[model samples]
Target chain A: MTSDILAEAMDYIDDDLISQAYSYSRGRPKFSKPLAVAALVAVVVVAAVAAIKYSDAFITAPDSGDSSTTAEYFGGFMPDKISDGELEYEGTPFTEKEISTFVEKNKYDLIGAIAAEYGDFESVYKISTSGYSHVNLGETNTLKYDYVDLPVCRDDEIIAKITLFRSDGGLSYTISVRGKAFDKYNSIYQGNLSAELAFFYYGFEELIITPTNHIYRVHGTEETLEIDRSMNYYEKYATEYNTFSYNELTDEKKYITVKPLPEEQINDGSAYTSSDIEEETAEAPETSTVRTVNIYVEDLMSEEIASVEWGSGYDLMLDRPFRVCTEAQKSEMLRFIENMKPTEAAEPVQYYGGGYIVRLVYADGTRASVVLMGGDQVYFETSEGESPIYVDTNGNASALAEYIVSLI
Target chain B: MDDTSIIKLYWERDENAVRETAAKYGKLCIKLSENILNNKSDAEECVNDSYLTVWNRIPDERPDYFSAFLCRIVKNLSLKRLEHNTAQKRNPEMLVSLDELQECLPSDNLPEKSFDARLLGKSISDFLRKQKEVDRCIFIRRYWYSDSVKAIAEDLGVKEDRISVTLFRMRKKLKIHLEKEGFCL
Candidate 1:
């Protein structure tokens, strides 16, 4: 049985699992149907334009070596008027009769269509399966479909290839996009025929293809693609938390702005503002011998990105508050604190982004803080000293700052 | 608020029931969604949707165990979201859990053996009833909620290796139990 079937079965008996699943009770919010429809229309138009532009170049055969095979394929698929090797979107659209005739003649099931852009050129690919048949699962039946690789050519160069097979009780399609460049060739698979095919460009370095509903917009040289703002709440959250812009590379236009959370919502202890920290310290025990350790880690590149904090029996930075450290974690932290050594001098090194600050409160109402710079060469600075220490392969740090990060 | 009180609020048609439920169980729903979806934003949406599902269902169905009722909705919703996201490729975490259970489960090729889902669920519940309380909880958490072994261990305040060993033994017992119940291995 599939995991889903088992999970469904378990749902009947498990109260805790059921409760955990339904713990969030905000009630379903209604979506704007008109906005959703508008977005869908925009996506369809973009896909259609891209498909027409790219497929036109590949479909029309020019006079060259082995041009007859290309001509025959085009003649069989395209109307006589368009088979003369002129690629134009303004030409007459494919009629229903032509589409049906093309499918029947090719002896394949037309599954779906996809379009992708690379630099100045665009490519459109068609998905189809040969020798596929619908069969009931309850009866013993022989599987159909012989595995075959069909090549699609452009100017005598094989630009795309399609391989079809059967697996997991359904037809599978593997579409490979090929080109003569580093990181140009990519393969995307569709286990089911009706799924949408998405192409994501990775910072001009690589192209990723998947069957996903999420829409992405390319930000030059950034590994992560920015989610389209017009999508769902999740897309908006991703854009706000995971993306950052380089001011030197491009003029900064703030695409994602995070509104400050309300005071009550902010008190969850997962994140603390500067004011909250100050207030907490103000209420600390004056004469108590209890040593309070607070550690704050930040992504130096993006100041807006939420920083992680560990202090006062809670890890406020984690998505969920780690109420208390386990015995092992406590020991590890102690070991890290003891191993920390004062540095002789601060070394000059390049800092790309991440760093940590550790605040230690002594029993005598004295406080000391340490700063650790993160990079290839890690530098540790304390109130009395600073030094460069070797970080081992196991990521053992010479200071509490690095050690706390490892624990988290 | 206690579960019975929440049910009472729903019975009284009080909107405060939704708010009270959110305050109490919202984090748990989000955690369950996060375990399955592995994306914070998707988890948040799934939790919100699950909350809405509870709001719509509770008036007609005052569940004996409110937590279970809520969790079931959220888990189902999260799984649906995951299915939509991974239509082309299976989620790696989900695939791993499924693969582990493959050894104990009847082969998918047994086309003639169409078993009723309710009967199978009853059989599983019977089997769990015979198991130790902790073992049953761990099994449900892993398979039903799709929680990571590390998470189960941490939640139970046990060592990760101990949890792994317990799960390994439990799966063996489940296989034997199912076999004894006349299902072909």
Candidate 2:
């Protein structure tokens, strides 16, 4: 068994696996813009400039004292008009009526926010399409839509693929306690998340949420989202600080606490920004083919692994759940078990009737009482731990164990 | 420099908008599409399509995260192309896989209760990470790290019938697992 252990893992690497992951043979998606590098570099530059400029403006109150005229333009006093939990738009640099009108005009993303406070009046009536903007995630996908030409609104998510344009009359969308976002006074606000808004306002990267789907790129770290009114959100989202009312705070004025949505539930796929929009198909003829490249992994480099069965005397000593299998498969599994460091191996043993307990030993001193059914149903698990080792993020597993009374 | 400004550059008919986008999300798009299509030409097509999609859709729409926005388009385009190719080839697995999701995933009729594609994807990943030893091995052997049931079972020394039943139950478990995570969104 020991001799066989060293060679087993080497046999498993399968050159096909690497190629499959690398080549995307199973109809995976590809991003192929010839000038992507230049685009990325420019984005960095732009982000830097926006960061520096907005950061400076956001930290100071836009209407700290000298800007009374600017204060009157934004209608910012509305926050005082509403009581606890009541949703209102008056005095809020953004008006409810404005978003409703925006949605009505575009009529592409037929999704309307059922006012969390007042169910009667639909909030943000902007945009629609009978299609009702939607998103569908499958086995292989990690995405966030932004700066797109389309809007997605559905019962589950409100994903706006396009970013708010500053040169336009629109403000970036704003979120209230009522669970909704709206962009009014286009160019006044950019419609980023509270965190993004904070960064935009404060000029500090302290508040931006990296997003969940991006966690893979961030090495799977789960980060929490933060938002506070002490930060002037308007400065980052609003292109024109004057969009706020007398009392409303702009980048240089006062800080209003903003609560970011719960990080756990934020659909990163729904995040969008303006500059990112040009990346999508822009008014070009549909001459480019539309498609998705999902790696089926199952289609390429499939190889047969040996299956094993537990011989007689395995039924009596077993406790709760039990399964059976062949010797060949068992040997192969045992070899795999031996390959793992001692700390990783499951305990191996063969339980028999009539008071006889025999622990099966692998060549590498690995012991297991595992049961493998016939064919390739290999059940390799550790009784000591809660989770098994071979599963990937998409719920893929290494094997399962089931007890079989008879042979096929 | 702002994505908002750059998008405006496009709507205002500025070609430098293309240069800006290329500077920001080009490699990410190229890599993503390339991973899916395997062919550079097809990958390029998907990326360009993504660009076109963004361009035509932006006037009435506003997004906060451009990378995610672009990624979704590229991914969807690539998947659509892949589906077309696979359908032309008459692959039974595609139909079976899709049919299996009919009961839980999004479709034309289901709205009030639908699954979060991203969360579901994550839940599946989480579930895989939680599987017990033998079960985990079987899963990897059948899905990710490996390919087919026959190969997985052969590697593990299990009967084909046993493997089939286990696979069935595994699928069932996955459905149940998703439900537990509020996959209905």
Candidate 3:
């Protein structure tokens, strides 16, 4: 079940992000015209979309029951003029046919952008994905599509379909602009059409189309007081606290040498030479054992602590080093440990909330460990038994927990 | 006045800081509290409390992001107020948002491990940075601001269904990401 930790975690999001949310709410662009593009792109039936082959791209029109769109003005596709690897946008090579195929395949909802005042259209050398609604097809003159639709983004790839809708079926061309253009166009357009052409673009603004939303329900409870206790622990401590892993054994290694028995000595108790024993010892597998134990809170309350090592998880798996705690803080923690009263409890199955394992090293090279769970409960790892011996610290659980977390 | 100016006033122990902060962010704080409490009076009271808390804490503690710091305090106070409210008085909209986020939790009972809220927050921010701007905007609006799906959709000029669908997909991705990050639900 989701705990308050998740909500608390939201509070911990980068301050700038929280500020960005405010900006989004305050700076959201208000569009003047009302568009009725079906909201759910996933459910929207692809209207009897007819592809009008214009230049190298296929200009698909929503089944607007007009039959007068198939004339010389609606330039047909030039199969022979299909350029091969001639244009590239955002590292993705797009041939004339490829662009047509992409637009046709996705069947992206198209918004009509009526190109105002077309000049001499020369060879299509490059497909610019810049934000400018006006594209220089060739000469100094720019082909301005007053109304621009926000690009459809698919996995970081922006493929925007600009359908050049012309009155009188005047060479209706379709151009594809992909990649970084989406951000650029979105910043400029801000969901508003160009106000320069209020006459033609006014009523046409209702054709603005939005991208489809793909459905995916991908993967969270509370329970009794015990569960609530666990929930409280998780919600309160899991997110607010820091955990440390305690490596119980010191890094010092002691090598031990073992000599194999002589073959004859095994059956007849024959004496083996010291040189032979040395040779066997040299050939034996080298064995090294950890020589020192870290100080535990239980065993070394009176002893001076040399240092402390901590890890995030229980299995001594270190994620990051614990922040250096002051000597006074260490003494205080030791005092808390001394004052802690042993309490009866069930076997420590799992904290299922939050905790850290702390290993204390004494000045005399001895070591001990204390498992701090949910701030209130402490477990002294004095034995290799199945269950941990739990301890209660009266009503100072939160203070102890805070102290433990602070040590991180 | 800007946030820095207001913060400066706080440092100078000038009471005008509270007034300036209220003038600038009172509406936002009230809106945020209202989203959670679903009670205008309660929301206003929480905002006032937040202002007092900020007034008391500041000068001693100067936040880098003054607005966000205030927002966090206000949100915490609002949630606390909601907790104290009776079930009948609780905001169902806020509960719905929380319930929806609950769905993002790990489905399988992986052994619970202690997680740093800051670390998780970083992970979430990283995930959001990789998302589309619109998606990220929608997410922060709904989760951070506690905005309803319809509200988010209206703000973004999209359908509520679209917002719902996008949220669903994002929640799924988040669950997967959290699982991969070794976080237990």
Candidate 4:
């Protein structure tokens, strides 16, 4: 009986996939020309399609007027006759063949161009990965961000695929004009975030990673909540949040340090070391224990008030692709947030459908936004980090955000 | 009616091709389009247009593979709608999805060939077909279907972190495959 039911479900799912396949191919134009015209169009289309093989390096968004794409903005991939090892712009899922082809084609530029670019790039360590990549251009504030990507139909590796950004916005010089390009992969080391912790969206709370690699989950609430070696890491070892390593008690070294979030931390999923749970919990240090999180909340929602002290230890966990913020910076930001007055969030004017998100624009122009749907639940995200924070269903949305701001 | 019967009816120009096609694959198409377009009327229009387009083309062209053919038809129609409705932020289900795949591809121009688009199209399809059913379905749902993180979790009975990790890994796999197929660098 179960098998029969499963079969029916499978059939239904297959039919659905087949039906939805159309949506996957959205944005394609319908071309119905005369047979001869179609024949020509087909040739062109086919040729264009075949050009999917043209993997080239290109640059990504360079703020253009209006909709943002300019003709020159789309630079062509240099021929692949590499005399040296310069990073090549192969398409996503790059095959060795494409790289070889690119290398071979650009080789002629050898000592003259591309090789020199790679040489200069190689002079500095260039790292890239599936997620995002960064290059340390030294104190000069010269940094570049490279995004791995490709466009439709064109073989040469485009340069823009790897997004290069500097804290000082220094990729400003005529790039590639120097022809010194070397690319590195898997360079940035984002610390481990437990898969379990990955589930909670810290909303606006900042993740503080001490130089010792101990990660503190701090939220700037009306009071201030900072979890670290200060009080006790074992106290919350296994509660709404858990941390094992940083300050494992004597025999407690056996407690497996599991990141609260298993997924975000990748391989570090959930670790188990200690034999006794109760003992470890009871031995938490009281002095360093973080109680309140002072948040400099900029935006306060309707009917929500900031609490006076640390409330229930928020079960909130910071989500990754989180852009880690520093303590000093957080303090500066919180002060700015508290002085700000709460304004009525504009009624969501039919944004695509029902409601839109409320955006918080900081004095420095930094922005954080909270999207509250029907149930008053909040999903907080910022322009910098990749992760989003989810506020508790019962907590005051304003208090929750204010708390996070205070922590930031 | 079965899929084969609908194709036959479509070619015969019974004028009820749309109705019959809807009967056979309406919900399926609707759900799929809804997954991507997220609009009832737009999804309905896409399916109807697919039926109409199929009806007009089938009399002259007979396809050996019916499902793939219908899928391609609907897929093209949905793309067209996305382009037409660009005034608003009506991104198709694959907006962020395709972005994930972007990393694995060459960071340059898209490949150019006579049949490159179709080839890459075939490549994606084949790649998808090769994935484990549950994993593939997860990818399609999160991506092609535009299902939210919550929806995918509820339907699959798995944790959201699992889905997120799975997606990240899946994109990596696709990226690796692209390198094998020699698509991007």
Candidate 5:
């Protein structure tokens, strides 16, 4: 029976009708007195906190005419005139004679500080140049402690290794020769180290030694030394406020503006210029040592799978032609590998349910696969004929599987 | 456990009321939540919270139909979770379901002219009761549970286009029904 007549008569169910029927079938439930009271208290507390947090906006605005306090607050830090020049690292501020004299006076305290900072210095070596002596302190076992490698220059070459460690107290540095340059020094001085002799960099070029309140700024060859108060401010606040726009604070006249040097200065033949050093230091590392890795992901529930290969001269995920994984992505992948640890099992546990599968291929053509079934049953397999990994509980294998799944 | 016994357990103020209710309706609650959230953990959390809500409300009021009561609570809780999770973005399932009903519903411009939701629900229910069984089930499954068109088609053993056309025709009939009932959108 075709219902053209009924269609014209018109009346069909809609969302509202369905919702009404359901609701009418289920009578409304009222909350108990205790529950009602608890809910009321929660709402009141939330409202009170929100009101207190936003109450300041409701108060009258500060007097806009008061400019004296604002001026005084900024007067101490504001520069008079800023010059447009590339910052060149001019080495340590101390001369050869001055460094020798300071080291002689504070050698014991310096040695003590180094010992305290890096357990103890097993040996000290020195390399003398025409102007200054390059000091090297070797650790008993460099692998015993965690250290970050910082490049230190000696005789215009980045051959010195500076290991920096940060503890709750402060920073400790251990400067040493890269290879067998320990025999070049005329004498080896070793003693207890103190905090005053710990050297830190102000910028890339300036080496700052804090014996007390005094700071020495050194440059290469040109020794036009000045006790600039602005240098102290630059060391203390430059990083935090270097990009301070004039409009964001006071008028343009109140703040000194340091603009970039002309492009000609950057291109012109200049020895040890900031632009040249930045370009050399910021270049990507050599890709010859990069490992090739492949990740495969499968959704067992849908029986759908996809994979992406990453390495030198190979990347399948990127839309552009012939582009490999970026340095950041490589670092992330390495970090994941460093933290990955799977549980070992005697045999593969069979599960006939749906889940996810993740397979990883290492640089040496070794393959590892993890199958995550329902209820936190994770089975892992490797091509090296190792025992299967089974994680009965939701633990590292489950988390690793999830992380791998996210990568693909 | 049956719905009647679960309600009786609640009436007795026993903690097993929650366990029994969950044993029966947990999967359905999670499915409803997942339909809106599209996330397993969030749906699970919403279902657990809905059970707590039932526990709190059962002492003062006894529901005639416990399943419908639970569905209402879980649906509301899932919607609230959806609101919180997608504050900056819209949930696609929720958007699609609401957009489909927007044609027959009133525009947002008439905010001052508030309509009673329960009254509208009754009028719509009367209209649905008059329709064929297949058409009514399709409409309820689509709008009430926020089920996808493909899911509705699969459940009813029909093609997706047929379900879509049927919904379209039902909407037209609903529009005529609302006009006859003197409700202006």
Candidate 6:
């Protein structure tokens, strides 16, 4: 046995497999303590900048260094004189008298410590409902909204509106004051309130902030209010970091040549085209005629696809197109495409070779064609006038390629 | 910095790319080399050489898996060093791992011109993909990284005997797979 040859052959092993072995053994890579600290500092700085830029009014500590100023502003302990404003609770408006009566009856703390401790209450009263359970992970995704807007009113004027934002690690409260309160509380001095506060002053339940999804269980009753915080999260964030283009590959770059299956062996099980075949100098014909807008692979809607077909230019046997038979398979195929990272294009020669081809026919009569190569790269097979585009599959293409090969 | 950012640095011809690569993957590359060469200085040298090769290769080849790409280089270089150092003296440490694979390899008598190391490697890779992740990891840890059975067991949190038995079964299965793929005589 040629053990030496076998030993050297280890070099060509798939990159993702190598990564999996390393990662499985080592677990996820962790930031060093210093790196973690640096990252935290950077996040804090960015948040501060964003707060200053976006917020109309900045809440500040009193110039006299007295916490009582904030205490007085929130009407500490004095339920009768807090404000003439009506505190809107879950669509039911309650006047200051009603709040004071409730506080008196319940023996609750009338002073809003959220204002005292945090040094300012922005006119906006923000409250996030509970996050939703992830369909795949079965864990609560700490996304902060499906936001319900509630206005804190002073007399007839709506002073603050609550805006909900999602948090994965924990619950957060950001109070922004507007109008008259904005003039009263807005200042240069800043204070940080990292924890979620439970107000005993009114009908509101204790806000539970947890690292997990088990948020806000009622004190005595078995009642639970679940909120879908992850609403539109994918539509908002996933596309931001994942968008890519094939403009990186230069004209001179060479791709692994894939050849059409031999004519005699087309549709037969034997003679799978080996990628080891020599490269031919011949260029692929300009077969692409479809023109698309600035659409990306991730932009393709699985529901809209009327048909999914896959074949290989290299394997003549698979030239008889294998249609995606199951909805699950179709979804899986689209999901894989969505996960592909934008990468540089290789030479347009891939359109001519042993590359795997997937054709998608949409219900609107739009057709899209993509080529998956042996190197775990994918490219949009363009038309006669369009440039070929490539994307990095990050090994997702291999899974897709395996699925396509399985059909054969 | 992320791998893409580091790769961009290389493409931009920034020298800091080497520093970043060393900072991020230096330990992994060294450990992989040490597993094979068994000499600390030689392993370090191999890792450094691998970094330089990465510096030169990138911009031309922006690897998606930067760690794997670097580790492969370090492993190859260490193997070359091992071959040179063991010309007169066989290193039993590495030989143990290779000998285990000897049972599954196809006939070595095929003419040199007929052997495509890459095709064989691709075949092995394709076969490995079909196995369970743990079994695949064990096979790669032992053969690709030249890790000791005890080390593999420790890394995987399994018994050394379990690793041994799994490797044995995997080799037999691989032989059958290769024979079916027409790689064996």
Reference-based TM-score of each model: 0.35, 0.24, 0.41, 0.31, 0.32, 0.36
Model 2: residues with Cα > 4 Å off, grouped in runs: A1-408, B1-46, B56-65, B75-172, B179-185
Relative to the true structure, candidate 6 has a C-alpha RMSD (angstroms) of: 25.8
lDDT of 2: 0.32
lDDT of 5 by residue, A1-408 (tens): 012112111223243444443332222111111333333323322232222121211110111111221111111111223332322221233333433443333333333222222232343412211122111111110111212223222222333333333223223223332222222110111111222222222211122333332433322211322223443333332221111111211232221121223323322423123332234334423322222222221211111111112211111111011111122333444554544433343332332323355444434433455455422334334432222222211122233344445544
Q: What does candidate 5 score in Cα RMSD to the true structure? A: 27.0
DockQ of candidate 1? 0.12
TM-score of chain A of each: 0.16, 0.20, 0.15, 0.20, 0.18, 0.20
| Per-structure clash totals for the candidates | 16, 182, 15, 140, 13, 17
Task: Kindly list the per-residue Cα lDDT of model 3 for residues A1-408, writing each as its tens digit.
Answer: 455667867777888778767766655422211122111111111111121111001123322123222111111111111122221111122233433433333221221111100111121111212212221111121223321221332222233434333333222223333222234334323333321111101110111111111111100001100111111211222110011101100111111111223323422423322332334335533321111111113222221111122211110111011111122223444554444432222332223333444543322333334455532234334222111222211112223333444543
Q: In what order do the candidates fall by lDDT, top score first?
A: 6, 3, 1, 5, 4, 2
Best by TM-score: 3
lDDT (10s digit) by residue, model 6, range A134-244 = 111112212112121222323223233232222232111223332222222111001112222111111112122222222332222213222244433233222111111
Q: What are the per-residue Cα lDDT tens digits for candidate 2 across B93-124?
A: 32333344343333344453343444455565
- Residue range A1-408, candidate 2, lDDT tens digits: 121221122123333332233232221111111233223323322232232221211111111121121112111111211112211121223233443344343232112112211222223322221111111111111111111112232221332222221112333321111111212211112332222121111100111221221111001112321223342233323223112221122222222111222222222423212232222323322332111111111212213212221211111011001111222223343444444332343533222211112233333544433333222222222232111111111112222122211110
Q: How accurate locally, in lDDT, is each candidate?
A: 0.40, 0.32, 0.42, 0.35, 0.39, 0.42
lDDT of 4 by residue, A1-408 (tens): 122221122223343454434333231111111234223322322222122112011111122011111101121111112122222221123232432343233222211122222233222111111212211111121111221111100011212122222212211101221111111100111233222221111122222332343444332221222222352222222222111121111122211111122222212312212222223323433222111122222233222232211111122211111111123223443454454332345642112111234444444444445443211223434432212223222223334444434333
Assess the local accuracy of residue B38 in candidate 2 as a C-alpha lDDT between 0 and 100: 55
Q: DockQ for each of the predicted structures, in order?
A: 0.12, 0.01, 0.18, 0.03, 0.04, 0.20
Minimum summed lDDT over a 10-residue window in model 1 chain A is located at A134-143
TM-score of chain B of 1: 0.91
TM per candidate, chain B: 0.91, 0.50, 0.88, 0.75, 0.88, 0.88
Query: Which consecutive 10 residues in model 4 chain B have the weakest lDDT in total?
Result: B109-118
For all the models shown, what interface RMSD does each have?
A: 12.3, 18.8, 18.0, 17.8, 19.3, 11.7
- Return model 2's CA RMSD, one decimal: 28.8
True contacts kept of each: 0.27, 0.00, 0.42, 0.01, 0.06, 0.50
Give model 5's DockQ, 2 decimals: 0.04
